[model samples]
Target chain A: MDSPNNDYLIKKINYEIKKRNIKKVPFLEIRNNRLQGVVSSGSDIRRVYVCVIDNNNNTFSCHTNNNRKCGGLDTQYVCSHLSALISQANLRSEEDEKFDTLASTTNKQGDTKARYPEVFARFQHYLKYLQMEATIESIPEMEWFISN
Target chain B: MTAKITLKENDHINNPMIFSNDVKLDQVFEIQHQLIQVFSNGFSKLNSKGIETLKEINIAFSTSPLNTLISEAITGLNNNQLTSSNFDLLAIVMASIDGSAYDSLFDELNKLMENQVSLIDNAKEINYTSNTEDHENFLESIKSWLIDLAIMGFTEINMDVLESFEQVMDTLENIPELMRLNVILRGFIEEITTEIPITSQDEFPAKRWLGLWLRSYLLTMQLPKENVQSIKDCKLKIIGVQKYSHDYFTLYTFHGILDHEGNNRLIQIEAKKFTINEVSNNELLDLLNSTHPELFKGLEENLVIQVKQGMISGNYLILEKFKTTTTSFDIYETLAVLFESKTISYNKQNPYNRHPLLLKYPVLCKIENITKDGTSKFDWGDIPIRFDKVGTLNEKWKLANSKGIFGFIQFDNGWWISPVTILGDKNQYIGYTYSQDRSGKNVYEVLKERSNAILRSKS
Candidate 1:
């Protein structure tokens, strides 16, 4: 489930990305229930990882390889690369919701999942090769990531 | 019992003028008899009334007749006619009189007496080359006389007596032959007796006398020039710099070692204190270096830093200065490098939670969107915050929470760090304020402790 302040987060991410002039956008894909990608600038590429936990009202835990330039994982605000990825994730989620509603209304057979062929193809690849796991539940969920 | 006075047939008395061809020798003898009788009677009265008689004599000496008589008596001593006994009587009479009245004559009599004593003691060596020795003996005699007068004056001092002694010393200082001797005596006495105890009542007069004496001595003597020359010739080395503060002055006392004429002595060579506005920074530094070379050397070796360039690359902060560059991944890395080869353990458990590096190098960080007036609009950045402006750590935490930024800021001209609330309405960014402890332990306190530890170890 998306956080209630998820809109605010999306807006903040967009603002930060625009302000920082983040040119190279990352291709975010969910793997093992974690959203991860490689953020690149020219020849330099930094790996970014984000995990959404159900506890703490659906908070996002983020980390970047370039901790110094991107700030530590424990930073209050995410780095520009992470913010860009988050904005993309929110847009993708909204598109998926719209597609789901359109398919339910238009077809009784429920075979309208392939409405956007490109998105369908990407989602299929994420499911098959990435081994994307369903969001699981633990008794006491991890509070925060300890980034080295 | 005719009260007849015996006349000595000395060449000075035989001069053909006063008792010459027209006047009888009996008239001359009668005149001498009357003068002797008057002196004898005066002495008897002086014995009966000491200070009163002296006062009366001072009055008489001021009058024309007695003044003339005193002048003539001084001249008689200079001539071959006056015997030592007669000179002694004349000196006694002159001692009772005011010296200022018969200044030149009295001075002449003093010189004649000095010369007579030298002649009697060292007559065999009486020549032009012995003039220096004679002058030295004369100086000794005058010094003793002055000292005796000073003692007497101090014993029964009144304003009048103090003034009289001052006048006598003043007159003596004016005399070219006695001037140097007077200076030496005054300086010697003052240098030795500076620590002497005195009653509150005596302190003022004593100090006045000393001040006047020293002023006259300095005015008349050329010793200071010689002393300065000697000092210039000596080798001076700075030992230390001591700082003292009072309401009016902040004094930097420079202690030094003086190697003068093969003698080594430690002394407080100079003290320089001026208001901040009164002195330039370069001048103050120069004075510090000159006066306290050793201290300056130590500071230059360790603490004195000239920042050429500071740049942040990734997590590494690079500082370039003194023809050398140093790079550290973070403040911790920098401090580790600084405290390198030392067995100091840093708090490495939660690295991102605290920034100890900001305390040491506040200039290394840059604040985004700083206004033209040099104030930051952001809640948190590397803004220069005054130490006094910083509230308590708990207070800072509240402000930081309100502003949505960490309480970290540079304080006290970047020497220390403190939790600060930026005084701007715009909350531009959500600054990192979270610490694992949840206690009031801010980054500043952690950095301060670590820096102090490093400093202590190095020191």
Candidate 2:
């Protein structure tokens, strides 16, 4: 079940983190063979983009409000949005959520669009942490969802 | 290095860090929960009980920051309803107080928790220190902190711990005995905090690190000599030979062999130190032998050999003597031995045992496009393995038509196999000048950086 094992994607994300000053990730998830998250833009506090990076297939999609595709598809380039999403995916992975990076991910080479709807929804749910989570007991969905 | 130097038994009582009692602790947790319940009900309905509870908790601890922050959080809400960011900050403060919560007090609640140390003492008697046990206690704290990082991952913790820990390490680094231990941990902090891990190569000396698990285990052993036993001679059909490398030097070679049921498993055994000082793989053949030399002729991956004798130390076998027999397996067959086995990691039937990192496996996978820059994933079973450190091409890749290749799959940030040799006309070994930095730093880098020193010197 090998997906993407932290090589190119992480390196690019690290560069983006420094360049964009992305100190607080707030929300991130690695599921269904790619790294995905809804990240709040540093410049625009109200703006958040649902970004995804599948290192195995070498493709990514950032459903930003614009039509621009991240440099992830271009040679030697990675989108800042996608980079922030993947920067901490491994660092944030919990125990039972153990996912093996799939070597057989070539099947997803052109199938990047299929994962967006679900990823976008997860991003919306993940945003709840920044709001008041008034419950006395810890919420299960907010389990790995950490904030400083 | 299980050399016992009995210190004191009541050290925990002598210098306690967690001083909050059960009753006070219960009150803290109770106050936190009620605060959440009140806040969760929303600020518009800020119940009197919740506000009173905040006042009570703030006053109870005599914690000034807590009192000021609590007031600032709710004070102006009625007048000008704070921004979502302010509400976010308040939520974080409330969540940080989640009961069973003393650990977080160090980071987010920095102004609160006490009991800190800044000592220069170099005493073997840790109990004698007033604030902190500058030697053994510091070592213990580091180990536990590392385990927490491993189990919880770096992102889960607040980044401030890194700065605080660096301060502690800086103060403790001057002690000669703690130098090696500090350097490794310091290397890890330097890498993981600043650079993302993408490969397993670093400036860390693997030659000293491979014995980490063995060292930590033996450190606690009371009957070190009694644990050493000998197996006269046995036939071992080698399953695989795992090599952990730093530069050109092979750090450690994990030899995977067949057990009685013919199941392949990776066993970690050092060439030395079983009892008082520990024995080697073949030392069991001698009643009181000092060293057991390893014979490597017949021990290639997927080869059969007759082991003349070996030592069984804990869960690993140290093969002192062995003869090369004839054997060969195709690529798929070899892959089956490496991955298809029921026990890829330590299990009940494994020759393996508990280890902090994953067992390195010998893997053969096709290379699509070798990472030319720092932005490509090296294909493993067609999946991409991120390789940021690309070494200059030293050997010929054109020799094999660049088809299937051989590499060692060990645990780094994730499971990674760094392709070292391509299956060419003959089995040609390839070389690369992998760039040494944070990305090239293996998760094992810090591992090598840490306890192998303390346990080794103490042993």
Candidate 3:
């Protein structure tokens, strides 16, 4: 069966994490895979796969293991990630506002840009690191593991 | 000019009525009508002309107040033998010729004028020729006769009786003003019927005690039946008064069930002298249970009394007497119990989904400190203070030990930490926390006994 809708669910999960202020565990390059009609019991079962990237750019994958699939567990996982991201973003936004306000007061445009180079550089580095992380598990194995 | 009164230099006498010949009277009239229309429609629609005209009037007058003008007007009315129509037009002119200049004065004049009843020429012809040496006593007797006639005519109408214009008027001339042609035209309908002959008017006794008792009853019974019948058979007896501050009214009736059956049943109960908000849901529930034991005799465990305050946000009701011996209590089961008791009758459907049982009374219990080591617990006595800034709570807690009760609790880092007691010893502990603060985070340790047991149980 086609994978469960991830794009919409991911945004919602990210939003809740940010809202709840939940601390993030160490992980990277998260992916949510929705597997429908995967069970062999003449009946259908849906599954969601969670994957994240580490500092070494390695992908770590997990799935909801309970017999009764709970939307709350999926929500909890995404919420934790979003919460960490939100806390970091809040701190960064405050610093950015401060920097921009300070920079606007400066007479030279180049000097102002130079003053916030480290912040811009670190943001770029994190973006590249996130993009470089790879998903190692195959679709067949993911489906097999999700059903089991 | 018919007459010109010369004024001394630096005289600040203000005449509110000053006219200019240069301005067209018709245009001024139109603008004045528009201004009145704007005011009638609401205060929001005041055009530039309206505002300017109002400002001009305010600037011209309001120096030597309108009380003197009113007194002069009263004298003029008596001397000129002016008709009620003329007096009414004059009053309207005084009110509207300027913007709010004579408003307060008019109000005072109206109040003074309402007390006196202006009788018709037929009633005025009854002249007593030196009937008694005491003139005041004679006039009072005449007034009493007039009052009885007025009340007899008024009781015909089924509408709730408020004080009438005649009852308010205190003067002989003012009494006649009530039946003025212009006054009637101004929507002041005759409160009493015209079938009764023009006897003397009667004065209404200011029923302050009755009004207070009714207000107190209404407040105590938050949501009474839709139709609160005029207290026909009701007799209010005062039980006791505490230093003239708290006066209690005890109403006794035969039928005690408070329901929406609309079966005109006589109900009676003893209620304490308290504000409407002070009537706790638990008390109402207890009364209900006691009166109708069949509804909840053996079903007490399943029944819950939910009292919500304000209904929008999360506020909790504490089953006051149900505090546990130890620390834990089943909050979920308590909530379930409360919700189950809310049986919605087909007739009593609430439009706001406000099930009567969902109403929650606020719980304001504090865990008191009894010892220095903070290990002892006791009943809270004083009002607890709330602190917002960091370090304020810690500092205040340290200062206000066993010496005295200081109302203080500090909120910081998504928690309200208060100095509370456990086993008769006082200690600092977390009082409350938001769910948003704990989502995806490890559960923070809280003192089991110190927390709002309901919240802890639910968690």
Candidate 4:
């Protein structure tokens, strides 16, 4: 009951990786009883991409880049983005501490995507990964960017 | 400070092969090669050339005994979606495909086949008079076959398992053992042979696999088939309807129960999928009056009618007379019939009769969850479980579902219900084909909305 463990994560999200075709995680943030992260898009790279989970209530949500309310809430039970976020989250408690029980998945309904800009700011790494931070550093590779 | 984080290794979570992505394309070819070698010379000789062809080609994996793997090889070979398996199975799959394409490989399988005559004789030995232990052993073997199909996935099961399954199914179909799970076996075969697709590397759904049928068969196998075969006339009230399609034709089988002359039976009748050009109830009634005045009362849900000179073929029924009883049945009654009769005794905890079908036939349902844009959702009893909305439920369904639906409902990749005409139901009965919607607006209105949107955008 301490926190989500490898066994629980695998049990909950194995299908997301195999069946839903989730590739890998792009970015994730794990805090007290919550996980927020950006998952690599399984189908489209430009898809709305953010995931949130509150272990306290086992409620979750997802959002587009603009933080518009999206399918992030819809896939709380079995979403690939949530799967990626949970798998990549730092759920392990004090290293040697063994724990049992998982965030019981009751599929509670609610969305907080209205605060997209505010909550979105919490994922500073996500903004960094999105290359939103303008760096004046030049790269020869920019000229070699393949359009196709 | 990034605390000393040690990620402990869990073998099941980490084993790549256990959670493998897919059978490596090279492995598929290798498996194909070894099987071809196995089939080259038939049972008599292994010339190393072998059974290199598939007897049938289909888009998905089947659960039917012999032809399933053969079709799987053709299907997966086409899609390159075969899951990982061991080397021996690779040989079997290739051989299965090869045998299907060219020779009847029974020459090889014949060695594994139980002699039908001897098998039947032994089965007879374990009759009602047989020891309890013998019956247990026999039933265990059958359950074992179910367990095998439940566990071994597509492109992974070996020939021996399939042969045993087929042999047991064949025996059960022919002998009195079928009396135990007759209705379930008929329905289950119809189900598996029709839909099931390729599965990935994961545990087979165990609760679903063991199934209500297994429980029912275990409970009811001891009961005797009532001496009601002598009944000259019987009413075939429908239990359920399933649709299957081939290249050209869409086929429908109406499976139902006939409780007549002190005997009860589960029987299925087949019909082709037909569209009614009639635009109203009066038009349909007129057509019935003109074409087949015998059905002047009109066909209702469950098609309640008494048939004379009816012949029962295995689990199927053939009719000579059709005199409409125009009987009225509740939706709950129809569902109860679909569930085995014994469970109607009622469960103490849940007031409703314990339905064996929590997943397949039973829907954890609430009505009016349909939408105008062709997406569908449903509420499960007290729990408002939201289904993942996908493409094309056809907005027209919302019209029917508004009053609540009671017919063949399915939860495949998409959710749909083919509303049936129950005599007593307040829900306005909509025929499977859209005849009532004369405006043509309601007919397939949202069928191609998504596809058209994609095309228009691309254009």
Top TM-score hit: 2
Score each candidate by Cα lDDT.
0.28, 0.36, 0.23, 0.34
Candidate 4 lDDT, B324-366, residue by residue in tens = 6767555445544434343211101010101111111222122
Tens digits of lDDT, candidate 3, B1-459: 111111111111122222332333344344444433323322233345544544443333334343333334334333433333223222233222321222222233224323121111111122222212233332333333332322233222221222232233223213222111112211112212111222322221112111121121111111111211222221111111100001011111111111223321112222211111112223323444454342232122222222121110001011112111222223223222322343211111111111111111111122344333332232322223322211112434453433322111221111122322111123222211112322332211111111122122221
| Structural similarity to truth (TM-score) of each candidate | 0.16, 0.31, 0.14, 0.28
Interface RMSD of candidate 3, in Å, is 35.4
lDDT of 1 at B180: 33
lDDT of 2: 0.36
Q: Once superposed on the true structure, which residue ranges of model 2 sit more than 4 Å away at CA?
A: A1-148, B1-232, B236-250, B259-261, B268-305, B311-316, B321-381, B385-390, B393-403, B406-425, B428-459
Candidate 4, residue A58: the lDDT equals 62
Per residue, candidate 2 scores C-alpha lDDT tens digits across B240-333 of: 2322211101112334443433444444432211110011112222311223222233332434656677665433566667655666444334
Predicted candidate 1 versus true structure: per-residue lDDT over B344-408, tens digit per residue: 21111011111111111111112333333333343333353322221112233333423222222
* Prediction-by-prediction clash tally: 0, 16, 46, 15
Task: State residue B358's C-alpha deviation in candidate 2, in Å.
Answer: 3.4
True contacts kept of 4: 0.00
